[model samples]
Target: MTLRADAAGRERDRERTLAWLRGVSGELASATIKRLEETLPWYGEMPPGRRSAVGMVAQAGISSFISWFEDPRATPWVAADVFGAAPRELLRSVSLQQTLQLIRVVVEVVEDRAKDGDDVLQEAILMYSREVAFASADVYARAAEARGLWDARLEALVVDSILSGEYDDELPSRIAALGWHGHGEVAVLVGTAPRQLEVDTLRRTARHMDADVLIGVQGSRLVVVIGRATPRDDTPDGEEPVSFMTIATALEPSFGEGHLVLGNEVPGVVDASTSAKAALAGFAVARAWRGAPRPALADDLLPERAFAGDPLARTALVQRIYTPLKDSSTELLQTLWCYLDTGRSLEATARELFVHPNTVRYRLRRVADIIGWDATHARDALIVQSALIIGAMSESAATRRRPTRR
Candidate 1:
């Protein structure tokens, strides 16, 4: 009989405490808002509309606490009931830390007001505050996760657009949204994709080198569009910008075992399609070169790419090699033709041109100077010979297309 009486008395005390909490809930909410304005600088700085929203949240929190006191089983809905009062944009404007601060202020106000109440009221305040803090963390964590997924999808879209050479007016805005830090020159690197790609490591590596990259994986191919994070004019004194070749060399270990091709640099990301095209073509034919270096330049693979029916490589050879040589002098072109035809023998070339061996040597030096490809080297000899053949064919085709005169 004594145990029953003790239980009945405790229940009556709980009812009286619940009544007192309900009566002072309005005063507690007002005090919480006043405390926030005084103690939290962020709250004071918020726009009037957001401040009102925050007030609504605080009021709802007090009401939810009353409901939770009546039934402890309502703990699951306490977070939803309190946070659901605010607008979705509130999450964006108010950081998780700030939300915790708001919770702390509300808890302080309730604890101060309920000091004279029973221990049950004080215990409920502590338990409720703990639950709300965890809920705020969960809300922000989910938002971050959703944001990360959206960013990955957007990045993939941007990379696909670059590789396909397709663009709309929105492409620039899309890149801007991705927070691209690249400026000025851009180059594309293509290689085989590794078994397990470590994207974050690659990004950290790029950041350390003061460069930026847009990475993509298409089947077996891995593509990285690299650019200078700091413009040339912005470079500090005596510190030159890191060259794309150096960046490529640093990033080479991240790629799978195969020939890695770096396209020629272009003026900007808008022109990256040209670089992407060259890199793709070079990568396709990289295996044709038996001794190709790990990070072989697309320009170096011109001969192989052209033989594989890449028109861009054919045009590059004609423009960078044949046009310059032809425009300079016919003698230089004729000498080069003879030099290669005679298996690169200076004596044989001199005899064919009816000149001294010294003249052939001088002309070969001019050829190297004009085209930047030294015919004396066996590899460059093949590239020069291929350019001559393609240039002659193009000239012949143009002549054949001309109108015949009577």
Candidate 2:
């Protein structure tokens, strides 16, 4: 009985030793990782105490192996299976069993703490991975903070100017002062996210595209983004959502869903702000016509953009006006481009291309012969103009899925 009791006590001590060793190894592993983080692209930053505590767990696991009355090298390797690294290498040429024994230590500590809780290893990985991803949290925080300040200033400018009812004169200077790059033409982007959060998302998205963002927000649904559109955006036709187009498409799934609309670029924010209203109107119009899930176009709310965003207008025109030339060989697309560019002046168009006016006249005649409509007539001219615009904007010259105009 005495000998048996001694054996049981020894076994109990062995179990305790293993548990402690595991914790030490896990802590040491984490510290090694932390020490190597700045060099590895993956080291995330967190509170120093938290970092150290995690590292210490693995460190304890390693040290316990050396003192647990085992051939430390041989024993650490036995723990390799649990710690998930070659314990032999970890324990400096120790056999796999020695390392694996240490891993048993870690698993015991973790299992004890989390007896009825979630997986500690997984939780540890999650916590560690998150910390590592934002290694420069302070830098991003500072940037995001500055971005917030800028947004507040801009939002105030928009609301103040509009409230004072001086939108016309105050808008241009107010916007230009924000440091936007392009001067010739610019588009408008409205967002569903709040100004502060949306600003962060947009800034991140812009950084993804190697650019910066300028922003303003009015109410919950009104977010204004000012930046150069780039080819890098995955949106169709480079129409940014929230920032440039419908909010739904602009926001990544990481952000969730909603609608956004981009307005046509106007001369100034006076016009731009007005255009935003028009863009909202365009969204409404496009929705009334195409319903939700349809892409709203800039011309949907603009005057001359009628056919540009008008679905039925173009289709009716295509079927009624251009059926004759649908399969013709008279180079109709070229003919239409020339006609529109010249403002329907055969003499001017022919002269610009050094073609005989009679030849220009004859082509129009052939166009009429094929389509059974003379473009020289104002009604016919408008219909042909629709066809031309659609042709320029779409994939095929033959026919098109009327842009999701709403």
Lowest-sum lDDT 10-residue window in model 2: 85-94
lDDT of 2 by residue, 152-206 (tens): 7876676456323356655656666665543333355554544245456666665
- Candidate 1, residues 211-238, lDDT tens digits: the string is 8888889999999999888877788899
Identify the runs in model 2 with alpha carbons over 4 angstroms from their true place: 1-151, 159-165, 168-173, 176-184, 194-196, 207-213, 229-256, 267-270, 291-295, 301-406
Candidate 1: regions farther than 4 A off: 1-3, 236-238
Q: What TM-score, over all chains together, does every model reach? A: 0.93, 0.32
Q: Please report the candidate that would top lDDT against the real structure.
A: 1
Consecutive 10-residue window with the lowest summed lDDT within model 1: 72-81
RMSD, candidate 2, Å: 17.8
Per-model CA lDDT versus the true structure: 0.91, 0.49
